[model samples]
Target: MTELQRKLYRQAFALALITIFYNIAEGMISTYMGFQDETIALFGFGIDSVIETISGIGVAHMILRIQQNPNTPRDAFEIKALKITGFSFYILTAGLVVTSVYNLYSGQKPETTFWGLVIASISIFTMWALIWAKMRVGRALDSKPIIADAGCTRVCLYMSVILLISSLTYEITGLPYIDAVGALALAWFALKEGRECFEKAKSISVCGCSDGCH
Candidate 1:
């Protein structure tokens, strides 16, 4: 790689590290606040963040691997990470589905969705920034794996929007089931993420593209 490309690779690797740390921090805060307010959406969102952290580690490692050799296949480390991320995502999906159903049937209501609103807003901004930066670096390097990682960030942006809307709706209408509905919405995304993880593992490319990670 040329010096400029190497620099871009460094940037890409840094972004992955940023994503991992941010997910960890977000997971802790959201889980705590979700428990305090009993907001299923926020609680589930927190769990998803934890899963993202695992995926981020794999992504980070992929960046390092490709930085050294762009044509490399998914290594054992990346495959292991993807498998863990996939299974965790499936478990979270199942748990969210069960919890959401029970909450709906029990007429459960959160004390407040205030924390959801806060976390979602912050996440919206953070995810957007990360997506933009990752995309820029990916395009600069002409790296498919990095671009696909950016796509994943876009998914997180979508989830944040869901959380924001659900939190605001519950706050505005005082609806008892809105939180559960939001959890269900999140569960759909969780299922998609889980499936993507497995698909990526099936592909040789780090991004799961059959042609190549580039």
Candidate 2:
């Protein structure tokens, strides 16, 4: 391997680690704050972060495998991880849907969505930086896997935006249903991600998180 390729691989691996650790921390903090504040949207978002951590592990393994041999196929561990991630996403979707419905039926409102706003703003900035860096490294190595990882990060970026908008909207208008609405939106994304994970496990060319690399 050339020195440039080695350096690019190191960069890619580092990005994967960053993504994993960041999601862990984000999940912990968001879940804590969400529960404390009784915000359905924030809670669902946090849960999603934790599930993303699982997928991130599989991606990291994928990076290592492809680094060793670009032509190597997906291994058992990666497939298992993908299946686990898929089930987790589906479970989360069902959970969020039920919780959101209960909240709406109960006419419940969050004490504060202040923390959601804060965490989501941070996530947006962080995801954007990761996307840019991953794209740069992926292109440097001419790696489709790395580039596809970047596309998945783009989906996370979209979720962060949704959280930000929902939180901000609720704060501005003091609406009770907005949090539930936001959670339902997240559920939709989770459903999509779940289906895609299984598709990724079965298909060689699928990107894993979102439908396609693009």
Candidate 3:
């Protein structure tokens, strides 16, 4: 492997590790905070993080596999992995949207947890850093795996921004619906990214496209 590829692989692995840690933290925080606030969005955010963590790990695994089998046919595995990653976001977003709308109609107030907000903010900031690093590595290496990993981190950033907006807005406005609105916005973001990723994946010509193509 080239030096650049090696660097990207290392970076991808690190990002995956971070993703797992962040998701675990999110789950704990959300669980603690959700019960206090009676807000499903808070809990949902943690669930979303878990998904992101899994996606990140999956991307990392694919990167390792591709590196080991640099000659492996990239036809179905690559395309399918990308599609699965993209679909994950779609499902997450759709679920959040439904939950947000339901919460709005049900008229439930979000519980205020200053600690939760603080931890979430910190977590989001860290994710942003990781995303920035991933993007740089992805560009330098021209590695699709790295790029896909970056995309996962980017989504985490988006999720964080939405949660930050919703939680802070709630604090200021005393409007619980704002949080739900923020979640809906996040859901839309997930859908958009998912569709785009799927399209990109579909457009790529895989190895073994035809007989002896690889």
Candidate 4:
């Protein structure tokens, strides 16, 4: 790799690490609060964070491999990772959809969502910052996986917004179903992302391209 490519790879690596750490922390807190309050939306959001962390680790591993051996043919690994990420998103979507429907049917309401509000609010800003940085680096390198990772972060931003709005609305109006609505929204977004990721993977696989497939 050229020095410039190396620099971008290093930046990508750092961003991936940052994503992993942030998501882990966010996932733990959100999951705990979600279960404690019986909030489907928050719990689903936490699960998404965990999946994103896995995706980030895959991206980080790819970046490291490229940095170490610039000529490595990354087609196989990239395809596999993309497929896994895409499949995970589909799983998340299914879970959220099923849970949301159940909650709606049972009229389940979250007992307290103050923590959900705070967590989602914090995640919004953090995700925006990470998205900006990831996009900048991904665009600089014309790296498809990195760019796709940024798109994943963008989905997280949307999820945070949904969580914040739903939590606040429920808190204000004491409407239990709104939480399920938010979860359904998350499911839709996840489905879209999953399809896109799968398509990207398919494209790369068909073209037999490496890391610079873009």
Candidate 5:
């Protein structure tokens, strides 16, 4: 690796650490508020944040490994980690779908979603910045795992938007189903991300490359 690439790897590692910490805090707050308000969407979003933190830790470990031994080939451990992350996403998708359907069927309504709105709004900006940094570093280093991690962050951004819109719409109209709809949207987004992560993992296992790499 060149000096610049080394620098980028260091930056990516730092960013991964930041992602871990941020997601921990976000997940705790969101989950707490979710339970307090009985909001399925917010609760699911918090779980997703926790899962993303796992991915961030994996990415950080991979970056450190690569930095320590630049010539090391992608190994089974890394592939397994990616697969686990991908599988977790699929599980999240299924859970969200089931929960949303139940919420819709039961006509459940949140008691209050003020904190959901606040958290989602803050998440949007934070995730955007993280996505930008991760993409920049991933592209610079041509690291599939880092890029895939960034893609995960992008999904989080979409979830934040969904949460924000659903919370706001519910606050304004007092519609209960809209919150369920947002959870469905989150499920759809997570399904897409899960597929992408699995595909990337397959590609790396077979050819040691991500989709965009030649």
Candidate 6:
């Protein structure tokens, strides 16, 4: 592999590992503190993080597959990974929409937590880094799966922004209901992105078509 390819793979691998750890931390926090807040937005955030972690795994798997077979046919494992990741995101988005609707109907209010805020802030920065790095690498290598993976991180970044806004709104208004609304909005965004990814994957016939290697 070229030096650029190796560098890109390493960066993606490292980001994937970081995403795994972040998912674990988020789940722990949700288990301990999520019940206190009725908002359900935090729960959605945690769920989304788990989805992102899985997507990261898909990306890592693709990179590893490529490494194992440097001369592997372009339409082999990489295309499979793209389809898998797209399907995974679609499911994740569906779940988020369901949870969001339920939260909105049930009038769930989320309590403001300092730790949650801190974690969200840290996640925002990490997501920005991941998205930027992935875009650079994906574009360089003409890798569709990697670019789709980067799209997942972009979704995460927007979700973080929604979470931040909702958290701040809760702190200011003490309405609590706004959190659920924020989550619904974020879920819509996820669904949109997820569908786009799915469409891209399904429409493409080959890994290195006009769009690029899958």
Candidate 1 segments exceeding 4 Å error? 205-214
Clashes of each: 0, 0, 1, 0, 0, 5
* Local accuracy of candidate 2 as per-residue lDDT tens digits, 36-133: 99998999999999999998998899888877876667777878888999999999999999999999999899999999999999999999999999
TM-score of each: 0.95, 0.94, 0.78, 0.90, 0.90, 0.77
Question: What lDDT score goes with residue 50 in model 5?
Answer: 84
- Maximum-lDDT candidate: 1
lDDT of each: 0.91, 0.89, 0.69, 0.86, 0.84, 0.68
TM-score, structure 1 vs. true: 0.95
The weakest ten consecutive residues by lDDT in model 6 span 205-214
lDDT of residue 43 for candidate 3: 64
**lDDT tens per residue, model 5, 1-214:** 6889889988999999999999999989988899889998898889888878777776777788888886666666767776887798899999989988998999999997788899999999999999999999988887776787788788789899999999999999999898889889888887887787788678777787422331
* Candidate 4 Cα deviation (angstroms), residue 180: 0.5
For model 3, residues 70-189, the per-residue Cα lDDT tens digits are: 556445665676677688878878788888888899886776745446756887888888878888877776666566666667776777777777777788888868877877876777
Q: Kindly give the stretch of ten consecutive residues in candidate 1 with the minimal lDDT sum.
A: 205-214
- lDDT, candidate 6, 1-214, per-residue tens: 7887788777767767777787767756753555565546676677666655555665666667666665554453445555665576677567667876776687655656454566678778988987888898778887776787787778788888887777777777877467767777767776776676566656655344533443
Off by more than 4 A, model 4: 69-71, 212-214
User: Whole-model lDDT, candidate 1?
Assistant: 0.91
lDDT of 2: 0.89
Highest-scoring model, TM-score: 1
Error of 1 at 40 (Å): 0.6
Worst 10 residues of 4 by lDDT: 70-79
Root-mean-square deviation of every model: 2.0, 3.1, 4.0, 1.9, 2.2, 3.4
Error of 2 at 13 (Å): 0.1
C-alpha positional error of residue 97 in candidate 3 after TM-score superposition, expressed in Å: 2.5
The best-first sequence of candidates by lDDT reads 1, 2, 4, 5, 3, 6
